[model samples]
Each structure stands twice: as C-alpha cells, then as structure tokens.
Target: MEMNRELIVLINARLVGTDPQYHRQIVSHELRENAVWIGAQLHGKDGTATIRTVAALLHVSPSTVSRWFQPGEFERECEYLSHAFKADGSLKPSIPGRGSGTGNDGQ
Candidate 1:
C-alpha cells in the first residue's frame, strides 16, 4: 500500500486532543503503531516495509520510528500481521484491542 496524504492527515488528527505534555509520547506511540501495521501489510502483500518506507509514510525520521519498538515487539507485530488478514486478502476491520493506529487510539 502506498502512503497517501489522507493517511497522514488522519494520523495528524489524533494529536488534536492529546495533552501537550504527553504529545511527544503519543506521537511516538502512534508512529510505532502505524509503522508496525504498515510494515505488516506490506509484508503480507509480499513486499517489504523498510524503516525508510515507514518513516517516509509517517513523515518522521527513520531513527525516530526505529526507536519506538524493541526487536521483540516488531517480531510480535509481524506475527500478528500474518493473521490479520481475511480469506479475501484484506486486513481485518480492526486490530483487536489496538486500533488501526490512525485516529482511533482514544487520543
């Protein structure tokens, strides 16, 4: 999946209601979540979601996105992504307790 402006705008919308003091933390979390989701989607589609690809999609530095997760977290996310799809090959509507990392994280 290609990164589009709509996705960027939707991600930005999540910041509106966040407390200023915790804004950085929230942004970091969102970036990490999105990176994992996107990475998984790409992987499912037989493509790779590199740090640069995810960073570019999120409009953040590659290092910033990299710092958001441990190796274990990424592996776990990848495992989850492997099962995140339906028989039709589309992702499920939601990612269980974790939202889609768009604007659904309760801000």
Candidate 2:
C-alpha cells in the first residue's frame, strides 16, 4: 500500500507513508501542483524561468516537476496517490492510523 506525504503533513499524522519513496513522490507532486496553480493564477512565470526554473523554485528535480505537468505519468501518480492514502491519513485497511488523533474516539 502506498501513502501520500502531503496528507500526512497536513493532518500531522505520524504514520509512515506506505513507502518512504512514495511519500517523497507525493510531497513532490503536491508542491508541483501548487506551484503551477500559483503561476497560472497569478499570471506569472512568463518572461521568467521556465518549468525547469519553477522546479527549482519548488525545490524538486526539474524532470520530476516537469512530470507533474506532463500528461502521462503525472496522471498515474495522481491516481496512485489518491488511492494511496485517505483524507484523515489512513493508509487503507491494511495499514492502521498512527497518530495521536482521535477521529473515531467517543468524547
């Protein structure tokens, strides 16, 4: 089972992502998406650094970041990441949650 690093970071969950590599891949992915949206929305990045430069701004390998905007593997990565982890940071049924959170706890 794979897990997303961003959700883990967002929810402050301690559960290790399915695979450390996958976790990194997810984080890198989110960062790329955020950057692209920002660039697109703000109407910036034009007459400026290219995607490779954007990758540098996001602190990821240019190739990796480029993959985010590209059509093929990027889409697959998104799918894998979605099925990888849940909103609350559960890594599917096989892996249990590992946080101090009490989402299902009775108050």
Candidate 3:
C-alpha cells in the first residue's frame, strides 16, 4: 500500500510539474468523482499522515475525512484539503464552520 502510494505521488508529481493548472483541475475532478486513487494520494505523500490529523487540519469531522478516503464518497471538501496542504499558503480559503486553524493543538 505504501509503495503504491509513493508511486502514485511520483507520477502525479511529474504530471503536476509539467502542467500545474491542468494537474489541479484533474485532481479536483478526481476528488469530485471520489476516485479511490485520488483519495489515497490525498491521504499523504508518505502514507504516514493519520486520518484524524488530516481531519483536524481540514477543520472537519473525522468521519467526513474518512468518507473522503472511501472509494466513492463524492468528496466535496477536497478543495479545502488541497488548498490548505498542497497550494501556496499565502491565501487561505474560508472553510465554513472551521474559521482558520493551523492544526496546532498545542502539541
């Protein structure tokens, strides 16, 4: 599973670098379709990031995040994750009911 995720990242990275705008559009579309491969890629580049951590970062319920990981959940909130973790942090998206947190729980 880990190896597969890494390979997916490598392929996507190449695609992303070659054409960033197109890559984002593809990723967004894949998420909207709830593609399992896209979910795995969103899981984390290293596959070590936890669901709870991802949920907290996105300011959504853990269940919502879990659904994003499912094979077909129509991940409407993926844009938030992509914007928060993948995009440049200069501008932040306003996520409803989530204000803006840096995922810091005073650890």
Top candidate when judged by lDDT against the true structure:
1
Better of 2 and 3 by TM-score: 2
What is model 1's C-alpha RMSD? Answer: 11.7
Candidate 3 residue-wise lDDT, 3-50, digit = tens: 688788888788666678887677655543444333344643443345
Cα TM-score per model: 0.56, 0.39, 0.25
| Candidate 1 Cα outliers beyond 4 Å, as residue runs | 1-19, 86-89, 92-107
**RMSD score of candidate 3 (Å):** 17.2
lDDT of 1 by residue, 27-73 (tens): 77777888888777766666455777878988989888777877567
Q: Name the runs in model 3 displaced over 4 angstroms.
A: 1-47, 71-107
User: Relative to the unseen true structure, what is the C-alpha lDDT of residue 100 in candidate 3, on a scale of 0 to 100?
Assistant: 41
lDDT of 2: 0.54
Q: For model 1, state the Cα shift of residue 33 in Å.
A: 1.2
Which lDDT value does model 1 have at 1?
83
Cα lDDT computed for each candidate against the true fold: 0.71, 0.54, 0.50
